[model samples]
Target: MDFTNLLATEVQTFINQNIDSDINRLLLKRSSFPNVTIQEIVQQIKGRKVAQRKFPFLLNENIIFPPNLNLEQASSQSTAEYKAKDIKGKSFLDLTSGFGIDAFFLSQNFEEVTLVEQNPELIKIVEHNWKTLNRKADFINQNLEEFLESLGQAANDDFRKFDVVYLDPARRDQNNKKKFLLEDLSPNLLEIEEQLHSISDKIIVKLSPLIDISYLVSELQNINEIKIIAVRNEVKELVLIIENKPSTVNQQPTTISCINLESDEPEFSFYINEEKTATSEFSESLDFLYIPNNSMLKAGAFNIISKKFGLKKLHPNTHFYTSEHKLDNFPGRILQVEKIDGKDLKKNDQFNIISKNYPLKPDEIKKKYKLKDGGKRYLIFTQSINGKEILRSV
Candidate 1:
């Protein structure tokens, strides 16, 4: 796809002028410029809109955006920058560069960078954008499996070895439905892990948050770290860092890092096996309630968190914790709460409802209580050692 006409000054200005325009109406209107169609112009407009938040670096002129699917799958600038912070090497290779967002940032610290993508048009767009941004990379339009095979078949003297290799495999299948298992991903990590290790000692793969950490630990070899990255308390990406280690030394436990970016929460790290021996102290309602962040919850360090923070778990299943005295710098939300009776909640009252390990969901609780949502106060419906309990934020 030639984006020359779409990069024209007038078209760029049009896209800028109507950044907030309705897409349906824009599609109904015909393009005034002969070189560009309404669809093309709208695509640029959509890209600019997404760039305003997702990847501000691409807001420059002549930067082309791919279709919605590619944009949707691309890593956000925050996450890419976070992942790239400690990564620096002489050579870097990105095996599955969808929109090149991760590649752009991850390759910054490397002296040499290469990007391989199966989509020709998307690769062209990425190449063009990289050039426009004054960054350099060897962009290859080829399937990653074949690329790995070629690298393996290279003559001994001509063989390449990147200091760091990265892959964010496509999680969607042919029907565009999302898949979570290691075997379901494109380029199938299980099949290519050995080959990837041959090319680079450090191989990093970004996975869907839906993937089970235990399954990954069991299937993958020599995993050094598993990072759970979240933005604003919402879990976003699960990154696995694999290193080629000797069989005798590979039995070391994997380190798990739970990070909640753009928040005051501290980063929580624990060994993958540490949670197994950790135990929790059960207690009834206390003065303050602690709710672990999504990343910590996803890490399943329920007992570990209670032990570390010196808080008591409310129940065996409930993740809620309580402490008599306020704990500073807990990596989650802390609210002053008190046990409340069901009769205390009045009809049509508005409160932020949180239901965890409870029989009814928030919506069902709302319906039965005749309550509205969103307010300064919170109604926590959960179980404690005594049984089902209701607590209200003070």
Candidate 2:
């Protein structure tokens, strides 16, 4: 699509003025500009609104945005920046640069950058926006598999090896249904894994948080590290780092890093072998209760966390940990809690209810105890070594 009309001073002014306007209502209206359709205008409006929170750097005048799907699939500015911090190399290549959000940031530390994307229109939008932002990259509008094939040619001057290769494969299938397996993703990481390792010494692939870490370790080769990243308390993406190099060790332990970005929580990293050997000591409720962050919980480092922090697990199944004293450096919420009876819960008492590994959900527990939600106080319904217990934050 020609972005000239969308970048017009009058069109941009109208979009900015109506940024907070109703999109559906605007879609019903007729186009004011003969060159641009109302639908196109609405697309820009939606893109601007999304960019406000997702990628604020794209809020420039000449920057063009693709469809809503592209914006939605693109990585947020926070995550992209975090991923780019430690990645520095001479050449960077992004295999599946859907919207170039990750590529734009990940390529910052590289002298040369190449972006390979199958969608011509989306790649054109990225090229235009990158030019507007004064960022330079060799944007190749071709399928990633074809590009990989081109790189296999020793005599092909157009294709060369990169220091680091990044891929955020399309997670959705032809029907727009979300996929969780490596085989299901576009460019099928499993099929291209060999080619990827042959081309770059370091390869970073962003996978869904829902994908099983153990399954990833078992399926992929040259697995150097797996970083589970979360923004605040919500798990965002699982970054799999592959290093293609000769090693004397027959199967080295994978380093798993649980990073809670945008929070004061310190990053928790451990080896898969350590977690396998680590054991947890069970105990009843103690003075302080520790709730693991989403990334740690997703990492399944329950035993290692208990062992490492000198804390005791409430039960075999319940992930909540407790200690007589507080550990300030713990990578999650630490609350001063005491065991309470059901009689202590009065009618209409306001609390932030939490139910974990218990018979009932949070809403059910609230209704059963006749409690109101949202407050500084916390009411936790969970299992202990003794049995089910109610904990109230003091």
| Model 2, residue 290: C-alpha shift (Å) | 0.2
Candidate of highest lDDT: 1
How would you encode candidate 1's per-residue C-alpha lDDT over 294-350 as one tens digit per residue? 999999999999888889999989999999999989989999999989998899999
For model 1, what is the alpha-carbon lDDT of residue 196? 88
Q: Could you tell me the TM-score of candidate 1? A: 0.97
Off by over 4 Å in 1: 156-159, 248-251
Model 1 — which ten-residue stretch has the worst lDDT?
Answer: 152-161
lDDT of 2 by residue, 1-394 (tens): 5788888999999999999999999999999999999999999999999999989999888778789999988999999999998899899999999999999999998999999999999999999999989999999999888888888876854356789999998889889999999989887899989888788889999999999999999999988999999998899999999999877757668999999988999999999889999999999999999999999999989899987899999999999999998889888999999889999889999999999899999999888889999999999999999999999999
Q: Model 2 — TM-score against the truth?
A: 0.97
Tell me the TM-score of each prediction against the true structure: 0.97, 0.97
Each model's lDDT: 0.92, 0.91
Residue 267 of model 1, lDDT score = 96
C-alpha lDDT of candidate 1 relative to the true structure: 0.92
Query: C-alpha displacement of 1 in model 1, angstroms?
Result: 4.7
